[model samples]
Target chain A: MNNERILLVSRPKGTPAMSDFRYEEAAVPELKGDQVLVKTIYLSVDPYMRGRMNDTKSYVPPFELNEVISGGIVGQVVQSLSSDLAEGDFVIGNLPWQKYNVVNDISVRKLDSNIAPLSANLGVLGMTGLTAYFGLLDIGKPQEGETVVVSGAAGAVGTIVGQIAKIKGARVVGIAGSEEKTAYLKNELGFDEVINYKTDNVFEALKAACPGGVDVYFDNVGGEISDAVLRLLNHGARIPVCGQIALYNLEKMDVGPRIQSQLLINSALMKGFIVSDYAAHFEEGAMELAKWLMEGKLSYKENIVEGFENTIDAFLGLFKGENTGKQLVKVAEPENV
Target chain B: MNNERILLVSRPKGTPAMSDFRYEEAAVPELKGDQVLVKTIYLSVDPYMRGRMNDTKSYVPPFELNEVISGGIVGQVVQSLSSDLAEGDFVIGNLPWQKYNVVNDISVRKLDSNIAPLSANLGVLGMTGLTAYFGLLDIGKPQEGETVVVSGAAGAVGTIVGQIAKIKGARVVGIAGSEEKTAYLKNELGFDEVINYKTDNVFEALKAACPGGVDVYFDNVGGEISDAVLRLLNHGARIPVCGQIALYNLEKMDVGPRIQSQLLINSALMKGFIVSDYAAHFEEGAMELAKWLMEGKLSYKENIVEGFENTIDAFLGLFKGENTGKQLVKVAEPENV
Candidate 1:
């Protein structure tokens, strides 16, 4: 058997370029005890991956130089040596950007294809969904009739966040980069108001949109858009920061107006968190998300780029706001299916 | 009887000047139903008062122009017609900065002069103490073996915050503007580390002091100092912003390195709050604080200036970082005492 994997050849400077990644071919090794030979079906590309590419100390360690980049990947078990997993079973794990992965059966969890699509396990029913779930519900805690302003409102987490806030009876206001995103959020996702940050004066637009002031701000794309939303925060506002896509590619330290004073005066809360922080309650979150989806109360979209070769492009496109929702790369299909 | 009061004659542009305040004399009116004529003993002048001085909305409404300035005042009941208060009883209330005030009996709470000094009710046992108590325990939640860093270590809230952090068995590091403040925090308060922010390279000093990174940052002075503390935050660090004394006097918008990225990468929490946010739990906090003080686990200091004439000067000195602890003006000694 053969395997091809993308390696981080060099660290990115400013914006990541194609030259930073290198694809190499290798022979797939035979499976050992408890090991399963899995073929990649779909790979998730997220804004947070950009941070791991840099050699810096963060909640998660930086990806090593010349190492295979790993993220949320859903694969099918082609060969198994453990009772926990069986041949032809679809599983999801934090796996490398490779055509084939030889991992222990315990490393991947078997997925129920009947619950949702195989790819949805890597998205809406997966980490992205859980990120929005815990960040919004646990931290943001939007109350009934309160206003919720979400940045990256058309992205994977944002879309889910807006729906969840709506479910909680909050007036949803979304800020996105394009008119298409703004329209989708307002029309499809039931966002009460949408601001096109790229074209609109975000500060003015936000002020106009949130007449009662923002009670909860679900921040995914931090920067100027966040600054505008922060200024209009109501007293006792909650801000759950899940991502900072805007600052991820910057080569130098990013500077802007300090937020502490605004937070101080408003008696607001701003918390930053990764999805895995709530690993203890992931089952509870995933169950609720699945229930919402099954009931038609939740919807998710995926910008699926076909083939393994386009993975880098899919990942890089996240910074450019190319994807409306979860960005994924389809490498192969389930052999048994 | 004659009464002298200081009024906010004009709105201050940046730092408050003496001209912004005007002294007015009025006749002390006769006590009406349930009214008490209270003579001011000690009036607190806090940094947060600067925010109220501006004609801008905050947690508390801005001080109305041409109206008498008001804040935490510890006074003695000189003449009472109500059953709640009697002659010579010490009381505290949010009252006008006047030599004598005729207010409804329900407006003031009687203080137990036996439990602590009457002045302590306005400092370590009152709003200032409650601010530190709730801001630290509720928001910061400093754990044993964690590093707790507090700015404005010599000020009213900071002093109590350090003591509380120490009580929780956390390693306390204090940041203040002078050697005297640093020495006091380290030598008298038993702070594990103290950084003289004015003379030291705060970033480097803090880094050296907190080798394990900051776990709880009680931010009283926001600006470059906060930026530096924010950078060294450990994962899940909690910051309770009590005040922004450093930016209180700024004429223009203050800008610095945006903090969301750092907070995100660390999965940290930064919340801004005033003492009144925990109003419902005041008795619990005040009881615990009193217990700590009686057990000799807590100590406080007050920089009390003499006479009603210097009230404006005392308030102005807060912007200059002039007072080491709770800044107050002794309007008059208790009439009965």
Candidate 2:
């Protein structure tokens, strides 16, 4: 089969432009001893993908020039040579941006989204869910009645973090960029307070909202705004470092207010994590997250851009703050289970 | 009995000087309910004291003007009103610069440093030991053969940290200001490498020392040096923030590069801790540290200045990097415990 894939044309110097990518059609290779042919259904666009566009040694290797970008995808297996997986199985795994992916069957985990939307495997129930879940519970360690503030609180991971902290009996405060998003956070998402960072003095608003100092800070946006929140931290505060969406556009990251001494004075716990760190707890995390979704205790949004050609466009939107929740690209229609 | 105590005569504007302190003789307070009269034997002079001397909020409250400055000290019970403590019992607790302190017996812990020096309780066997042990294992979480580097390497906490990391089978590197302290780290303390920050470019020297990126960073001195170390962190590096000796003197704190992004990209965990966080782990930590000390697996040094009048001088040496290990002031004659 001829596979359609979007290749990275250039490593971004700053925020990536549409010109940085090129769409190409290529022949999909035949299955190897353990390889499986997967028909791509959906491709996940995440903040981490921005890191892959830059040629820097990090958690994952940088995307090579003229190679298809890789990220989380939900695919349907059409052919398999391995005993682990068979044809007609819907599995979720890491797949490059393509209409079709030639993957090793062993690397795929079969997904049954009859439980919820399969695309959720990319957001609330996937890396986003696990990230928010572990970041809040493990890093934040929010105690009952404590004020927990999350930056990017209307976005994918941040939205879930606020809800989860609320579930844990914390007074949740969210900081977002839009008035609509802030409304959704306060009225619908159950955030006790929402600060529109784009319009308001975030520091002053946050101070007014959280008269008690910040106890748990689930940071998804790291920039000048995070510094504002740092000042209001109570003694023994916990900051869970998840994503820094604010710096994705910078060629050289800014030197904001130095936080080391304040962190020392506050005795804060600031730690970073990739959802992969909590792989040991994913089953429990996914199961519990699924329960929250089914019971309507938590809500999530999916901003789907149609067609594989728009994958790059969808990913580029993340840096621009154009997407509301989990940004994903649908490559094909899924067959009935 | 006449008791001579050092008082903070005036608040410091930025860097504290001898003029800020005044030594005067006063009456020793009589023992009351639940009180044990302690004759100060060895007075500790720690970097944290500088924070307490300033009229600012910190992990611990700041010392007021004309107040007797208090810190961790190993004293002997001269008289007791509580059944929990007896006269002449060697005890360790927070004591002011005064020659005598009437403290609640529950506030102090009895120290029997049988296999080591009694002064070890003021450092390695007490809070500093607990700080390094728990901070590294619980927060830093060093893996075998992984590279672990610590700043302020020859100081009391840093010495114990590198040794403990070594005991955990990690490759340890120490960074200190002076060549002598750096030498003491590599030669006397068995660290894999040591760098003199005053002479060497920390970034270039760190690149040379940690060919394999630093897996764990025990940050004692947080400043520009820490910024350089953050750049060399491996994926999933752990940072246990035990102290920040560098920023204590600044009248107004200057912010460094925003490290939250580096932390996120590296999946690093940076958490500040006061050894008291693991008060429950005291028995376990003390036993393990004691075992390491008895086996000659860990070595310690003390920079003791004779006479309580020199307490401010001893503290100022910390900012100047004159102290080798634990910085302390000897107030009066020993109780001969």
Using TM-score, give the best candidate's number: 1
Interface RMSD (Å) of model 2?
A: 1.5
Q: Which stretches of candidate 2 lie over 4 Å from their true place?
A: A1-3, A27-38, A75-91, A102-110, A334-337, B29-37, B76-90, B102-116, B335-337
- Tens digit per residue, CA lDDT, model 1, A1-337: 8899999989999899999999999899988989999999999998889989888887688999999999999999988899888889999999988999999988999999999999999888999999999999999999999999999999999999999999999999999999999999999999999999989999999999999999999998888888888889999999999998889998788888899988999999999999989999999999999999999999989899999999999998999999998999999877854
lDDT of 2 by residue, B1-337 (tens): 8888889999887788778889999988777889999888888888877878777788887887888888888888888998988887888888777888989989998877575787888888878888889989998999999999999998888999999999999999999989889888888989999999999999999999999999999999998999999999888898888777888787675778899878887888788877777788799988999999889898899999998778888989988889988888877666654
Which 10-residue span in candidate 2 chain B carries the lowest summed lDDT? B328-337
lDDT of 1: 0.93
- Which residue runs of candidate 1 sit more than 4 Å off their true CA positions? none
Global Cα lDDT for candidate 2: 0.87
lDDT tens digits, residue span B1-337, model 1? 9999989988898888889999999999998999999999999999899999887877799998899999999999999999989999999999998999999999999999999988999999999999999999999999999999999999999999999999999999999988888888999999999999888999999999999999999999999999999989999999999999899889988899999988898899999998888999999999998999999999998899998999989988987778888999998878754
* Top-lDDT structure, candidate number: 1
Of the true contacts between chains A and B, what fraction does model 1 have?
A: 0.89
Instruction: Tell me the lDDT of model 1 at B81.
Output: 97
